[model samples]
Target: MKLKFDSFLLALLIAIGLAYFFPQAVLFQDGKFIEAVTTVGVSLIFFFYGLKLSITDIKYGLKNWKLHVVVQLTTFMLFPLLVLPFKSFVANAVQENFWLSFFFLAALPSTVSSSVVMVSIAKGNVPAAIFNASVSGLIGVIVTPLWMSLFLDFHTENVFGDVYWGLIREIIIPVILGLLLQRYLGGWASKYSIRLAQFDKTVILLIVYSSFADSFSSGVFRTISTSYLVYVFIGVSVLFALIYGILYVLTKYVLKFSVVDQITAIFCGSKKSLTHGSVFGKFLFLNNPSAGLYFLPLMIYHAFQIFLVTIIARRYHRRKEEESQ
Candidate 1:
């Protein structure tokens, strides 16, 4: 029952601690500097993602239409629906913010690396996992915003229009450009995938640090008590378990998937992407005082999912080995 702690999760905790104690460190409190750095970093992250993407794997993955549909619906639709009922109970702005954080966590995409890696470890359908994970991010770029627009009204004039435009400029355009050059550079991207992943985590850490720094400096967390964070942690835990459990039943019994496909379905369907959470939050919550509050649930969920899934994947791996004998 021992679970290994991910170093990046540790780094995330350290990033938050640093932001708390030294909000102004590296001039992050100034806003514009960190904004500029993270903006470029976000684009580069997506670009590298595009460069490393495999069109063949996606095509191969599409053959499993039933599994793909189930996983996609779980990720984009069911997760949000599970949380939507609570919105009616949001009695005040503070409650709404917490609710919105939960909604955002529900709306996010699946993790690409972790989902595929875990599926592989569990002797699951790896190609489908890769395809589902990759497509989930692209889908989230559009879907996440539309979901948020239903609940959030921006201060800017022409808010939705501006948000879409920023998404195109910062995320979509870079991905497109990277895909275009992927034919020439894709190999290089794959060769350096591990390094690029490190680069991605670095950007995410910077974003986390900058976000919390702003929140800390502006006294945003003062509005939030330690007890509220416990509630959020419990909230995300329930959301993760609920979705994971639902996918398990649907894939195992209803869909009658092979154990491999079931593994892919549950793992890819239940996870959310912190990388996307960080990048999309920058645009969605731009200059909002509560930006850090919005990200808190996602960070907690990201860490929790990794811990829980690693255990599940390892057990599946062990069972497969035993059966092979």
Candidate 2:
């Protein structure tokens, strides 16, 4: 079998390189144009997310309460707990932000599209995968901010209120509008899911470009050395492996779920969403020049998870085929 590379990952790296060479181009006429475009793009992405969300599927998959519980807890609780112990090790503002970047990655929801795709590839519980992946984003809208608030002290006097307000305006409200219109346009959304997914990625690429541009322009990355970046990348890879291993043990032994559910649990629970990270980072880290740095670990984790899960999914696929044969 041949190895496949993710084109979007390549696109992201190219976006960063373009940002480095042409940071000035990211801003046109006081930067208002690009900012407005990205803000609207972020809202529309979530609106489409709500439009594609299936209430019936969620209700149907509710029967697998144990499976849902394990996935959600691992996503919202276990991942953060594993990283929380390192807070004491952070000694400076720079280190704190870097550590917070990892924490942010830990707090994020699982990827909706990739989780379901991987589980399906492994012949796992598809409906449950769909349901868990969908519900995880909704849960993240609330829980992720709460996790950040515990450690982050914002520059604003009304920081807490501002955080939720931004979330409500940029994410929650758009999702609600999409949900309300789902019955009318949901079929159309489903019909164009592939196109819509492409749109989602375009917006994410734009966000990545703008963020790195701002960081480069502001000279934020100069503070971070080459060795530090290497450590961060390694830490992200290790974090992925640790979570994957723990979820595998939990689903197979502690929970004693079926092989299919085990596959779903491990895949879903161990993944993180770059889409959500981009949108949520915009609101949560607004006006922070080093925002791109916060996204570094998430970008790494996103690429790493997809690559690793694809390999695992293929192995599982082969094993099932062998058993049947």
TM-score of each: 0.96, 0.96
Distance from true location, Cα of 143 in model 1, Å: 0.6
Shift in Å, residue 186, candidate 2: 2.1
Task: Give the per-residue lDDT of model 1 (tens digit) for 16-128.
Answer: 99999998874745667788888899999999888988889999999999999998899889999999999999998789989999999898888999999999989999999
Error of 1 at 21 (Å): 1.8
Clashing pairs in 2: none
Off by over 4 Å in 1: 25-30
> Model-by-model lDDT, in order?
0.90, 0.90
lDDT score of residue 114 within candidate 2: 97
